[model samples]
Target chain A: MDIKAYIILSLALFTIGIVGVLVRRNAIIIFMCVELMLNAVNLLLVAFSKMHAMSGVAKASPYFASDAQVFVFFIMVVAAAEVSVGLAIIVMMYRNVHTVDVNFLNRLKN
Target chain B: MNLTTLVFILLSVMAIGSAIMMISSKSPVHSVLWLIVVFFAISGHYILLNAQFLAIVNIIVYAGAIMVLFLFVVMLMNLNAETEPVKNYRLQLVGVITGGALLLVLVSAVMKIDVEQLVEMKVGDQGLIKVLGMNLFKNYVLPFEISSVLFLSAMIGAVVIGKKDETANQ
Candidate 1:
């Protein structure tokens, strides 16, 4: 399979995720969108890693190898952690405001 | 098309469709369900890439655990279809345009890359769990330990944030 197709699909998913995060009023959905974006990037990163591994010359290059996948593993851990904290904050916001709309979260505004 | 290509096409379609549904559905529960489908499709993609370990972890973490938490939160909130706010057409238009612009940029960037050069690199068989474990325990140990700390912080934050305010009653 051509790598371009995979890249395109990842880009599309990332774009959709960006739109969802920007337009959605619900905090939970926005958080999901953020996850979607992260997943899309993860897909692209893994694809690049595979592409590099398949092409033998990348072995000499310090940046290319299964190490990229290791980076991706860390990214997954970080993303999971982020979602946990983010959802907790969202829950706190809901407790005080009874709503999760981003536009209405203007308490800091003087 | 070969089996790999065929599987890739199918999984691509499934992933994209479910992701679209995840964003478009009015019901949050329905969206979470669609997200589960997306997660499964992504796991299939990982399998296609020969990352068997990643595929299993993907299903276990995202599909099995995280999604269950999502569903539980959705149910606990009692968020019904009626409670969802409707998106205004103007905001939707802006979102579409912004998203479209980002997509265009990414597509163009990808198109300009040289795939043949990338395909010239030799793939090693050292991508399996054995090699990965060796690398993680040897070279990447610091990052690995740091990630556990990060997870600890996140857990503490979740507990503090989710805790009910006892003083409010007084």
Candidate 2:
């Protein structure tokens, strides 16, 4: 595998997430974009994990080969938890504002 | 290109395309569904990388659970195009410009990277469930437990924050 391809793919996904976050008005859409960014990072980490396992230093211990993969697991865990909280917050916001438009929630601005 | 590269290209296009559609789609429900397609494409990438455990987990956590939560919230909100306020086009133009600039900066930075070093990289069987499980339980057990605590707190916080107190409102 040319690891560069994975890097390019991840960068594309991250850019998409960044664009979504910047362009979208809906709270749920922005939240999904954040999840997209998280997934991009997860993909990069897994690719690096495999790359490192193939390299020299990880020769002594196989455990080190999966280190980055484990980080991906934690990321997925945090994402799951964050999705629950974030969606709940979005739902609550919709209840209060009657719309999921993010621009409407500037009441907290200084 | 070999089959792996071909598969990689297909997954990449699907993922990036769906991600774009997810943001542009007017309906939040359709956006959520598009995001699910992105998740599945990412899972396919995981499988191609030989990270089967992560592939399955990606499907379960992302495609299964998180997307369902998003769908539920969207439906509960009863949001449609008319109900969904449209943002000013000027703001959208700026968003696109900024996003495009950032993408250029990042892609340029990545272009300078020395991928030749990684070409010699060899993958072990560590990505398999058995190896990953040993690593999780033995070396990373503390973080594993810590994540559970994080999940518990998130659950409590979501419930507390989302609860509608009718008496207080009345």
Q: Identify the candidate with maximal lDDT.
A: 2
Chain A TM-scores for all candidates read 0.89, 0.94
- In candidate 1 chain B, what residue range of length 10 has the lowest lDDT sum? B117-126
lDDT of 2 by residue, B1-170 (tens): 67877888899999999998988988888898999999999998888877889999999988998899888888888877667666789988899899889888888888888765352222357678998999999999999999999999999999998899778867
**Per-model TM values vs. the true structure:** 0.92, 0.95
Candidate number with greatest TM-score: 2
Instruction: Check candidate 2 and list the clashing pairs.
Output: A54-B122, A54-B123
Worst 10 residues of 2 chain B by lDDT: B115-124
